[model samples]
Target: MISESTPLAAVEQAMQALLDDVVPLASESVALGEATGRVLAEAVEATMDVPPFDNSAMDGYALHHSDAGHTLPIIGRVAAGDSPLALERGTCARIFTGGALPEGADCVVMQEKACVTDGHATLPGDVPEGDNVRRRGRDVAQGSQLLGAGMRLDAAALGHLAAQGIDKVQVRCKPRVALLSTGDEIIEPGKPLASGQIYNSNRPMLVALLEGFGADVIHIQHVPDNAEDTRRCLREAALAADIVVSTGGVSVGEEDHVKAALEALGELNLWRLAIRPGKPLALGRLPGGDGQLTRFVGLPGNPVSGYVGAWLFLRPLLGAMQGCTAMAELPRLWATSTFGTSTGPRQHYMRVRLDFSREGIQAHAFTDQNSGVLSSCVGADALAVVPPHSQVAQGDLLECLWLKA
Candidate 1:
């Protein structure tokens, strides 16, 4: 393929290659205690109705709607988890919150609204029909699926499941990922650095990024600029993980050994993207001597490039494995630019801070967006995607994606 194709073409190639190979991980049944942050491997349907029976919504007198605005004698008491009892005719029951209403009661008056004295409650105002009563199946009906097979389990989901007496769930096994960084100039943090050595921030950031995306970050390390060492590292990554993510040394620069190592181990395609911060991306399969294959992505070492590539690539990769349709999609919006801009042949994703101003959503660059600058990403709110060869005046429509908080 010619190197001068459009950016979308390159993105499509990389995305297609990844999509063709990302098989779903194994399935596991786990108690709800550990289901948080795990993807659902199967749908969860409510086997029993929520609330189980007609219950009071407030601590008050449970009475018939016909007794509204009438003073009825409280003859029985019902608290939460108690058996429902019959309420005598022209009588009411003093009920506590979440307590089942008496068999003849259909509504509840709030405690503050009804004056009670010695087993008698005077209900005065016109109470709406069935006021403050939660009927069976109000929260979730039996046989209705509340969560799907591929949904991400969140707090609300767990609460819903608990309401229906579900204490366990089946969830997808988290994908195992191995992270590596290539370059002789990179070193471990907290160690003495010689000249031209920088602390390895990419490993930490990438590991966090993978974990946040639902992948179990298994192994992480830095490989030197030697081809043999890089090859050995790739072998370990491919053997121990379903996907290998590495930064730096994919370009044509001397001492860049990652590309050669990948070629020696498997089939590789290097992409020249039209996006700023990250343009040189290597994507393909790692074929082992035993004929096993694993996916690999080689991203630029520049912090912004590495970060963006993860968003644009790693997100989709893991999202496909989980079967979430929306997770892989790029979020785009028309943001009002605070400054004029022009673009070269490459598409530019300018780090921006956004605010709601007089002209509505106003966006300005985070800093002088040199691809190598890392601090500008600290408070970035969005990315203004400037199209190739396009010019925009101040206050013009700029497409942007909101950064995850």
Candidate 2:
């Protein structure tokens, strides 16, 4: 329902509509060693307490608090992983870091605070009870929830699982993506180009983006301007992929036949957006196997346009398909603008380099904001947002989306 003049909010709503139809993939069991970056499909609970037993937190003399300020006999040593011994009421135990505390000991005096002689140790004055003791279950308690569903398993999570003796986990399957590029004037990279022909840059860029986003690229195809051929390719892609992303041939030109082929195969939910650098975007659903619907995203041919469209549409769609609904909207934080801008009817997402100052993060827009100028995106860390029919002066606060996000 959006056109080129629609607001960014309306475009976001249309994008969400397409995502609402996607279903998360089924879960499968994976070894803990291979679970990094995979989405957790089930909540994980700790079977045992971290630091399962009460132990010493440092290398010190373990003794009863009442024995403080007294030169006590060093009856035994309890190093880490060694069996704990019972301490005499007036004696101490030589314990190393992470060592077990003796049963009769109620406190630990750090080695620096205690004077150790040939066979005895002198404790500090008035040492408190429970000093230098790491209590059992102080970290993770038994039966406590460790990780939640839909969370990505990172290095920290993996270490936590290893501490709990977990060897396997259940994770969501990666979505299968079909990538296509169209245009008679476009040729594949690494091949000689004819006169008036340009190499296809959007496909490689999109494929890399999809890989970094963690989706599995199932097929990569290039099609010409033929309508019948486009329709046939669409059907085959929908049958084989959970989502299809294509670049070029979705606009109003006579050679643009992707929209028509999509309309014939299924339903078109969105055809345009109100954002600069990428206004010719198409979103739809195609008939899939087993009565499921395969999502489709058509981005403009220009490299900059395709990049913007990917961030605005394809990323959110992939997130939704993986049950990450919170990623439907990008974070928009305020930043001071180093330069001014005059906007027109459509919303503008200007590439800018971010600099941190005493005031805060500042956005500096590139001199060239043209859609076809892909080089402008280099070294830019964020996209500074400019609303329609608006103007701003230098030092004005503007909202921006971080590129790394």
Candidate 3:
């Protein structure tokens, strides 16, 4: 339904509109073992203090600070997990690492700092109070917020939860996605190639990217370039998935049936963003059962276009849907440019490899930036954003979006 008179939408404007329409999915409680890479739905509070009690930092002698500069008789021994013991004045308890500090003991003299002879220990004269002792709640306090909502559960975060005796947590459910690849000329790999047919490369690539963004790909189908087939596929996808993403058949060509089919089934909210290699991007919604509407995204057929669009658009969309604060935006850093380029009315996202050195970070752009050159994306570290009508030169600072896994 887009025409020459249809103005191009800025990238930021389109992104904001898409995000505004998202309604996060439901949350569920999952075991800690299964929570890796999931976003927390609620904040976690510490049930008990970390290190529960004051303990020795290492193998040491637990003693009162006043006993400094004196040879104290060894009254008893204590190791980790032993019940608390009372320390008499002028007497010390031989304690090992993580051992609970005894009553009346204010400091621990490490074994290396003491000389033991004939059941007595000689301590340094200047032992300070509370030295080498890990106080209760030093790492985390009881009833304090341990992890905030919308935080992704990484290894360290999971370990922190384990420390708090949390075996399960509430996390946002993964978004269900349906991916469609259009064009009859596209053939699956390992199939005998016809004269005019090319192997389908977008499916596997997009699947990996979608999974990387924490989406559960529920449906994957190749749609032939026909209005009837496109509409049928879109309807089926909408019914089964929360989001339907398609590649190809979005441009204004006669063979492009996806746009017409989308308009027939639902509403086309946006089309034609002002960005190179992905200008013909489409955003729409499709009607679903139970009065629910499924979100839709149409990407260009070029492999590079699909790849770039996945990072620029799909990543943030999924992040917002899952309420993940960290995934809401790509991490950007300014890097010195190692190549020169000029842009037109549309902004360009060039794939580049970053060089981190003592001096600073530098971006090395691939030589071939054409949309059809999928090889340009291999091992790419970041996307260098070149603004419209701007000329960039070597040594100039350019903002780059880091391509994190």
Task: Give each model a TM-score.
Answer: 0.93, 0.91, 0.96
**What is the C-alpha lDDT profile of model 3 across 145-232, one tens digit per residue?**
9999988889999999999889999999999999999998999999999899999999999999998898999999999889999999
| Each candidate's clash count | 0, 0, 0
Show the colliding residue pairs in model 2.
Answer: none
Candidate 2 residue-wise lDDT at 348 = 90
Using lDDT as the measure, the top candidate is 3
- lDDT for 209 in candidate 3 is 96
**Candidate 3 off by > 4 Å:** none
> Per-residue lDDT for 211 in model 2?
68
Candidates 2 and 3 compared by TM-score, better number: 3
- Ordered list by lDDT, greatest first: 3, 2, 1
Error of 2 at 296 (Å): 0.5
In TM-score terms, candidate 1 sits at 0.93
